[model samples]
Target chain A: MQKHRGIRSTGIPENILGYLMVAPALLCILLIAIYPVFRTFSLSLTDMKMQFPNMAKYIGLDNYISLLQNDRFWSATYNTLFFTVVSVALELVIGFVMALIMNMPFKGRGLVRAAVLVPWAVPTTISATMWKFMYHDQFGVINDILFRMGFIDQYQSWLGSTSSALWCAIIADVWKTAPFMGLLLLAGLQTIPAELYEAATVDGASKVKQFFRVTLPLVMPTMLVALIFRTLDAFRVFDLIFVLTGGGPGNSTETLSMYAYTTLFRNLNFGMGSAIAVLIFIFIFLISLVYIHLLSRQND
Target chain B: MHKSRWSNIIFYVGVVIFIAIIVFPFYWLIITSFKPPEQLWDIPPTWWPSRFYLGSYIAAFTERPFLTYLKNSIIVATSTTAFAVFVTSFAGYALARLHFKGKNAILALALSVSMFPGIAIVSPLFLMMKEWNLLNSYIGLILTYTTITIPLSMWNLTTFFRTIPADLEEAAKVDGASPFYTFIRIILPLAAPGIFTTAILVFIAAWNEFLFALTFNTEDALRTVPVGIAMFPGQYTLPWGDISAASVVVVLPLIIMVLLFQQRIVSGLTAGAVKG
Candidate 1:
């Protein structure tokens, strides 16, 4: 099943047939992915703004240079990287633990798996809003629970302060996305054979030892895949941050995407926004290259 | 045996906490939607609503164009699903069945495309849409959604199509069936389950899409449920009740679907992830 079953052709060669079949989708991808990227690159080189679309001039790398010197841009870069690193690291740990538990033989395993996916299934904005409600200073559920247990003297406004706003955003993000990591890792877990564990057990290996030696090696590729997906997604965090804090209290939670969005839409600064957009793409590209390098090396 | 019993108890406890972390927000959202305004801000909170209140849901419909938003979301999402299915099916089949010159190249290209930061294209897409007079149009949004979904759906479908044994298609070929005829009659029917699963996946993705929907369709009449909810007007102060009600309306169906099709979604999502 690694290769698709090829049929015996009578008239047309397989190459031509393949081209004909793939043409529509390839065209759509070109229009959808490649064209916009090329367009963005061109747009980045100009002084384009929505209000004065006709007054645009070719500004060679000015937007990029200016963005480099801007403190706000640096903060967004730092914030995005921070969110990506912290949330992804936490998600990997939590998701791995959840995956291990889900892989355990038990009653109601199916139900439990479904329960774990609920958070991922909910829309991001909705999840953010749900957390916002729970983090409400005056009547939030989290505040109520913490206060009742004597953990706090009184309720606190979680999203209103600069210090805690980004972290709160991260917590909400981790809650919504950790299940996605769990699901991907669980898929990896299921693919490892039970016989490996049996063999380890026959050799008198402890469960912990077997996990390190047998399970980890077998599932590393799938884990890498999950890591790459989650990292890329975390780097582009938008809806949750927007709905939760709106880059808030004072630019603390402003991700690259949020900054680009505000520049493009709110400020109507298309040229600078495209430059930020390009920078974000370069960051993603570099990150993917690093992971793919790990991927290729793993093949050895 | 005694140790195993202790491990089992620990495992169940772990599962309970996992479920709690994931599901509590949804529970809170539902409760908040039904709580009367007075109980909403109660210190220590009324753990449960005294009565199920429909006031917020009523307000959601009356004060905002909530129902219209639902209609708009359905239109764009369904259209995107249909377009995705039509294109990805043929592309998946080609990648799976026929030996092509750039087969590996196309697969790798699709994988890289999946990693693209969508916001990178937002500015360009906005300008392009405006130039084409497509801003605020459903067709414009549908086109964008279709592009966003193509890479993953194609990868998923290609994986799925590979699972169909070659012998069945060869048998159809032996019966003098044209290749197109064989695909139409044999492969398409067998691929129904995969197509349905992919369609559901794409539909959900498009439904939850916020960035494009927010920017492209700025008109009040064309807003999707998510943007509609996020951009719902607040007067004087924040409208928590109405917002919660809209969140419930948007999320409840997805939660129900995930529960009903848990196995399908989990497998489809994992397949898309690992293979991509």
Candidate 2:
């Protein structure tokens, strides 16, 4: 039935009738997605700030040049990459393992499967706070557990130190985000037919061999698809870092989104904000292009 | 084969530990919410509350107009979701089913628009909202959220709508129903899962939304859950216990909804990921 459903979408006719059918939504997407982005590009060229919008000057890529020379932009760029690369890579590995575990036949698996999603379901801000509390210097759950185990005599201020805070933020992110990766990969795992694995088993291929030869190849595409999604989201993350550390302890956890936001809102420097916005957009667009290429192959 | 059975046990145990780690923060919140103010900050860290105290929620209710904020969030979220789904379905149906002159181009344009960072236009949108006098109003938040939500909802729902058989629509039309009625009666009902998925996805997105809610709404009366929680800690700082309890209160519903309808929600999320 599903196979038949896929092959026969060709019969629907195009009509002004069909166009009228969907105009409201098309217009909304147009105005929201396309128009504002273009406006942002235009706004990037101007010397606009909060004080006076009407008397803005068009300086033509000077903002971009100034952003290139700024130490803060480079720092944010490095931090964003560190966050994205480490988190997405870890998520992919952890998520794949969890996906494999959940696919196995077991008792009370339903309950366990549902429970794993709780972290993913928790709003990122709340989860950050949850972990923030857990990581507190004196009274945190993490400190309690570590203290009980005699890991250290003195309490650690996880969010206070410059060297450790960003990594701590990454840990909070990984804890909340890995479940999401696991779920996406698990769905991918379900799509691979069982018969191939059975045939491999009958041939006396070792379980690891069967997995490498069959599962890994089949799941890579899906993992690639999932990776693109997580990376983009991680790159744009603001609320979690904002609430957890406020990009604090000497700017250790600042990402492009927070920097752009602080520039626009805190300093009211629209020009610098728009320049950072363009840079982030360019980086995302380049990666998205790679994903789009992968997608094109998948569709074909 | 029997040798690896031990490995299977190892895998299950490992998975259990992982899931436990995943769930503990939220579990902590629940326990914290019902604990008394005095015991909220236990030194040795009490694993469970001896008794459930309902007063934290009461204070959460009484300390501020909790119900009013909840109502405002619902109205804004519901309206945005409704407008978004209604608009996206028609637009998605059109893009998917109709042979528009710019069908492929339209889809490409939609995808491209998503490239711009939300912060870039935020200033402009902020200015635009102020110019139009929508700051602090539900209408303002709704419009701002709608811009993001509509694109988001449409992108995912369109993928689902495109999968439906068009012959069903054609048959409904052949029975003398206008295309509008046919869409309303035939296509929409069959697309219930997609619609509901859209609703759940939109609700969570709206409920979790923060920047606009915080920056756009100045009055205490207009805050939503995210903003509510952001301000929650400050308001009850003197009583650290109540603040933790209230943080739990703010997030509890979202956690519950996502856990209960987890399968649907995950699928909706991946549809966004997989397609976009």
Candidate 3:
């Protein structure tokens, strides 16, 4: 194997063969994923509108300049950031607890795990719809349960109120994703050797102490990765919020992606929409950078 | 002993609560799908449906053109899975087994592409599809879906392909078998489980995809499940019953897949994260 590692018997050098093999997949990604990003960036630079394609001209960041002054854009940014932080935080805590439980040697663990994945398996849009129904003010199950339990005198408008709309979306998101987060954390938990716990126990470390000292530190990498995955996902959230609230009750639930969608498709202001798209990309890129840095630092 | 017993009781309670929270929404969805419209909007919503009413399911198909949506979803998801798996298998093989410069760079690029927001590119893709007259077509959605699906498939297959020992290929080479021949005959068979897992994950992603489907396809016949359910008529008065029925139809297959291959899905999903 070492002898033939440098060059294959077929005389197509390994490096050249590698390029040949990856070409098709690379082409697809470049054209579809990479090229469109560049196109969006370039489009953001021009004053393009779907309504007047012939009148399109170079605008040189005017869209972005105006976007900086746009109150709606700022609100959307705040909403996206708020959603990403709160949902990811809740998911992490809930998912960590769920992971610890699933990691236990319990009967019916398989069944429980499968049940937990039910939310993850459901489509996001469906989840949004289901939660929307549950959060309905008058006839919603949430209201019924709360009212029946004497938690509230009357059913409250969850999605209809600006104060609660984003929270409702957040709750729905955490419900759909906490299981997935738990699954990821469970994988990390499994990677910890059994002997580590045994040794900690021998040292007379209590459960809480051992968790803080051993499991928490060891699972940090997985947690960070899962965090970034959910963070970016939450930042780009569209379908759930779109379906659930439509960014309603005075645009309280509007996200950057929703703003971009409304601009590009609904208003047909291609230039402004492209600018929002570019901004979304930049924000996501910064997030990836920070996490990658943290990840690498952790590894070292 | 008393303390441990109390802890055990608490643990069981925790487990029960966890299961209930995760499973209740799904149970409600199924229950609502069977309830009559009046029951659906009752002052105190019925905990359980009085009878199995098939009206919602009947309406979902008969009234909303759900069959066409299901058909389109299947075609787009299946094509995306096949094309992504086929293309990425070779890339994965090369990354895993072959000596190559720029392999890490390519992997990084793929990873970043996976993170790229679908919303960011939807407009340009819409325009591109328009120019090619590919909008509202299966091919357009499939091609776009591949871009999102390929990265994960590549990473997963690469990770899986690396688990396979090179000795099999070495022996094949000693027998004068070509590299391509070894990959096709030996590596692929050994990597079948990994490939299958990747295929399932890709299919689910493509199946659940909403943004591109919403943007590129306006025609009802071309709408995927997510889009169809999202764009359901009766905007003023939402059709919770029909929507729930459609959601059940769409989610049932996914539930079955997760139940049957829970282990494989876990491994595939965590491949990049845990390993990296």
Candidate 4:
């Protein structure tokens, strides 16, 4: 399955031509990806504001030190981690179940499959705004329904209280994204041969036993891939929090990305913001490195 | 024992609730959008429209540059998608199929950039725009957005390219056609579906992109729909009717696009999610 890429062709002229043809792509990455990243590293040193003298004094490590001590930084980190872990755990379990349901031979499967994607298809900001309305204190639909059902007598401001804000945001995210997880898991599920399930059933393997022995092992790698993608996405979350609570009823829902954005543009403290950015970058890089090692091991 | 009837009943109950969680918000938005101004705060809000009115939509545009903003969003989204799909395809094909040296390294680097957090570099990016005199320009917004989405588009496009058999390209090469010629005439025709898929995916991403739209565009005129619509209820006394109307207009086009390309979108989700 591995396509070896150690220079297969012999002719020098055509090889050079091939290289020329691919220059635009290399240019895009150089101009877009590599350049912005370098700029990010550079901008971290500046105490730039929104106004003139965009470059501030290069207070090298002071910004980094200040961020390390900031109380808000610790709180944001906890919220980010909480948001990432709980939503992902919930998504994985529910998504796994949804994927399993879709995998079954059911009537109206095609219609149901498309219906599952309604949330994922909607734009993030749009969906967040919509959910915020539903979470509105006075007349939001969620409060109304819960009130009628005797779940909570007082109107639950889902995005207002510190206790509930982050989870409320995650509920919106999970609603919007779980279908995506289901779709991905379903794809992974399809690749699994039905014959494997057949072989297990014939071997007198209990359904639960078969799942543990056969399904879990085969799907773990794919599931982990999904896990890493979702985890990284959850870690850098911004737009939803911004729209839902504007980082809160007093910074209750403020995420690291929102914090970084606030420090950079809103507050115009590029040095501190960039330091925060750098921290996030390092954290993400370390996480990916671990996952890459795990993934490659599985590949081997 | 096989699954009990009670378990099946419970599963259906769970399924109905899950479907409600997904559907109600949008349904409420649609219903709210159609209601008249007096009904905005009606007690015990109706699930369906009380009466259809076009006034909110009219008010939405009258209050702001709805058409211009929509056009600007279309221009930015369309151009970014076109550039991304065009550039990434050539590169993706080369990386996926060409037996070039250091392809692995290039692929790895590309993948790494894809994972780079958007928030990590957006500030620096803002500074870059200011330096370049790109303040409130469509081109600037497009350029920055193109960067944010390149990794995603490239990965998907490359994978789509990789799925194509090399012999297809080679067959034309063997027939005395040049590689570029074969690519344009032979490979591209067959890759039309992939191309379409990439464009739609990239377009939706760029269209839905709020960070750059919010960060890069300071002028009211330069704003895209997401940033534009976010500003609808901006002032203290926001006209609720207009906000709902604008929301409907902004989101409807996207929903329509998805429905039109329903097949491709589904497959795209499958590839993106399943392959991870």
Candidate 5:
């Protein structure tokens, strides 16, 4: 309703007025969010370790080159991608089913919906630690349940080994984040008109047929958007892995973000750390571009 | 009718499974928090604690300055929420109501910034904070948290403000009310639900934030809940019981908030997510 007229009574231009309204926020964001990013790029090229403190010299492309050849960096990248792909895939299927169930005409649906959000609302650090307790080899309930269900022969350390540690972290991530995907997809489901379903029923389509023909087609865009969002979040995951395994069992669950954190803080290698950080930023930027490209193609 | 009945059964089964997956972890968190240290390492984990033990909770309070952690968490979360909401309201209002140049660009930039890896900037931001004498302080953590939360809140509040009816603002303006007056009195009151939703979301994020809290706050007195719990040291052993109790303390407020405001949280989440 507040249209941008050419000029106000005091002769202030409309564009300037709009800019003034948004300036404070934009300034905060630029100062806090955007500027540090550029600074990170500058730090990546220099050998700046916290321990050294005095000598700060730019050795251009050396950080990036060394990082590219580093086995630990490559391994961390693999772990990150593997975790993101697997967790996002699981969350997609599980979340879609959850969304469909939420859309159904059922008693206590509101209660069920609220119940589902418990996982998403719980902090990642807490959930990761909670899962760490649950995965304890000696006393974990997971091993107990699995042994009872004849899934595992004996109690095993879920986070103690390199192979199983990443999977364990993945499982925790899936549990925590699937509800977020479900919430997003449920929003998409709510937009569809009931008349479409009625029409499908009148045409003698089965429920499965209706889902494939109507629901899937209609909700696919939303599903992809959710996928992209989850992918980005998963790729940069640090808290879950940090708390669950500390990227341990020999860096089995190490992600790029974890790698960056370790180098920046633990090792105090700011030069290499910033390089990893910039690579992460570029990876996310590229992934988002691909997703947006797909989105635009869909619009056409 | 038979087909409908079968489908109903299937629906109920799905609901059961979904609820089970979501609720099981929290149930374990609660049970673990209450379990005695001995029971915690039992051969087969006890599903229920032995007679509702309160030792862990007491330890959570006494052993290490956990109450300090709680106090700091509350301060940081509340401050970050208040600051983020206050700052984003203007930008959100402009994006939603005022037509301006570079609006879409600003929105896109904000969205991109949302994806900016917080880890990437931590080095510089850390150095900057140290230079500013803000490292290990509430203001440092709050300001950093604001940067992360602002983008998400901006997108959410912008979408939310756009949903309010335009006619009300038009009527207020027709009554010769100043733009600021109308925004403060008419528009803001109307956007209460959106603002509340955004505030809760930001609060939860700041409360849960670990890296910034852990990196910035080295002093035990200033540490927030997540960092405190993560860095919680034990004298004799790993202190699983105390850690569990601390986890519960960190998450219980969030669980309560989520359950109480499920509808608004869901809507807020969906609104930001749907357009993506």
Candidate 6:
């Protein structure tokens, strides 16, 4: 008990010491993460082309106005939203099934778990590239397999056509990320006690009913959290699209992040690029707000 | 009994199919790495390479400065892990054990920062790096990586530090040990497993990061593995062989790490999600 007094009587006050301890990390976040976001917001207000930095000037809401009228921006937004909704929906379903399978008492579960980590462990660029090769129009295994199975009469260019390119990218994304979602849901599933399931079974509930009644309700919070995480991640899809199709067959698969990269780096349109970047930040910020609200509700 | 048998068959079949879907791409990657160019372009791709032709692996290293990319990735990832772990340990300790004002605010800040879309901050970070003349340097990427890695590391370490009893710290305090001193000498060693877990996760993240690495370091010599493999010249013909080989080289170490530290990684990842 006297030892507690010793801690209090130390030279530096605990609050100040705490602040000092956290200063470096806080500074890093503010400078590298928080400040840059504000900088991008301000940059979005100016007509700052990277090529001619000297001609930069404040052009209040013109960039945003133009972005609203620009068909490309709308298309990119549509593409991003579509990708997010489709891929996240697929990931959630596939990942939920994976979780259910993983939660079952099975032999060689460790090996299955490790195997599931393969896609998640691979870098996004690498996985995208791998899938790109597999979707190669002429020499692709996917085309070969589909043809052999009599699914298609001719080998189709999966990534070379606009109609199918985005879907192809979504498939690749679901493949890469479903494992991660599975892992998160598996953690959630593990926390559910076996007693509840046993109790449900004893009450003459079928397996399917037990899942809907016992499993789903308890895991709802975790699923919601995982859903938002994947939604936000899917919304920011960049590396996969970058390497897989370079947001092409046209701008068909161009995500907001990819569009921002092209504008900022390739086209060197700093202001427009920043505008796009700011929109992405806003979208992600809103998604995060929903997450926080959900989390708070769960806590209550 | 009949119903149980039917369910058992379905369960095993589901497990097998799921595992196959998950493992097929990796198997494809490994096989492609060893395939000769002739076999790679076969009408129907060969499921198995006829021979272990090591040409692609050799070419991947020799054709481009891949060794440099590998070196850069190692330097950036290791430096980021070291810097992030050092910075976050103190913050975690403070948040976990200390009685302080605005602790919740800081925690909330960290949580939100973890979810920040990198595309938003990238442009300004690029300009800042340019202004500081760090665009092509390891320091620029390392600093940026530390920023992104800090929040999770803080959360994870704080969760870990909370599990450790305060009685040990009190005893150390009574023996005239300074808080900082007790932290470095006593607390850190005690939290080594948590710290190591955080380090592995952070290292994997830094290793696999693409957007920042791609944006900041455009110089050929400065590229990391992800960017290097991605930006491989395919002007005439895409070098599938070399690219696959390079992918294998980079992915092998990560696979090994995940295998060795599977349980630790799971717990570390879910620490924030499950408990928060």
Reference-based TM-score of each model: 0.96, 0.91, 0.97, 0.93, 0.95, 0.97
Tell me the tens digit of each residue's lDDT in model 3 across B111-179: 999999998898899989998999989999999998889899999999999999888999897876668
Interface RMSD of each: 3.2, 5.3, 2.5, 4.3, 2.8, 2.2
Q: Which CAPRI category fits model 1?
A: medium
Q: Of models 1 and 2, which has the larger DockQ?
A: 1
Instruction: For residues B1-276, write the lDDT of model 1, one tens digit per residue.
Output: 999899889888878888877778888888888999888878877678878999999999987899999999999999999998999999999899987689999988888888888898888788888889999999999999998899989988999999999999888766766666677778999999999889989999899999999999999999998888877747566678888898898887888998998888888999965553
Error of 2 at A211 (Å): 2.0
DockQ of 2: 0.46
TM-score, prediction 4? 0.93
Q: How well does candidate 1 reproduce the true complex, by DockQ?
A: 0.60
TM-score of chain B of 5: 0.92
Specify the highest-DockQ model's number: 6
Q: Give the per-residue lDDT of model 5 (tens digit) for B1-276.
A: 999899888878878877887788788888888887778878888899887888999988997799999899999999999989998887898888877789999989888888887887888999999999999899999998887999889999999899999999898767655565567778998899999999989988898898889899999999998888877746556788888888887777777888888888888888766675
List the candidates ranked by DockQ, beginning with the highest. Answer: 6, 3, 1, 5, 4, 2
Tens-place lDDT per residue, model 5, A171-216, is 9999888888888999999888999999999999999999999999
**RMSD versus native structure for model 1:** 3.3
What lDDT tens digits, residue by residue, belong to model 3 across residues A178-290? 99999999999999999999999999999999999999999999999999999999999999988999888899999999999999999999989999999999999999999
Residues A59-157 of candidate 6 have per-residue lDDT tens digits of: 999999999999999999999999999999999999999988888778988998887777887899998988999998888889988999999999899
Task: Quote the positional error of residue A243 for candidate 4 in Å.
Answer: 0.8
Cα lDDT of model 4 by residue, B1-276, tens digit: 356777877777767776676677778888888888777776555566678988888877876687777888999999999888887778777766666677777767777887888877777677777779886998887887776677777777778877878887777666656566666766778788988987888888888888878888978888888887776676676466676778888777776777677778877756765565
- The CA root-mean-square deviation of candidate 4, after full C-alpha superposition on the true structure, stands at 4.1
Candidate 6 lDDT at B178 equals 73
User: What pairs collide in candidate 3?
Assistant: none
lDDT of 2 by residue, A1-300 (tens): 343333334334547667776677667666555676677788889999878888899999999999999998899999999988888888888888888888888887777677767776656666777777778776677878888899978778989998888888888888878877888888788878999999999999998998899998887777877888788888887888888888888888899989988898889888778788878888998888888798778657
Give the lDDT of residue B93 in candidate 1: 92
TM-score-sorted candidate list, best first: 3, 6, 1, 5, 4, 2
- Supply the global lDDT for candidate 6: 0.91
User: In model 3, which regions exceed 4 Å deviation?
Assistant: A1-11
What is the C-alpha RMSD, rounded to one decimal, of candidate 5?
Answer: 2.8
Candidate 1: count of backbone clashes, pairs at least 3 residues apart or interchain = 0
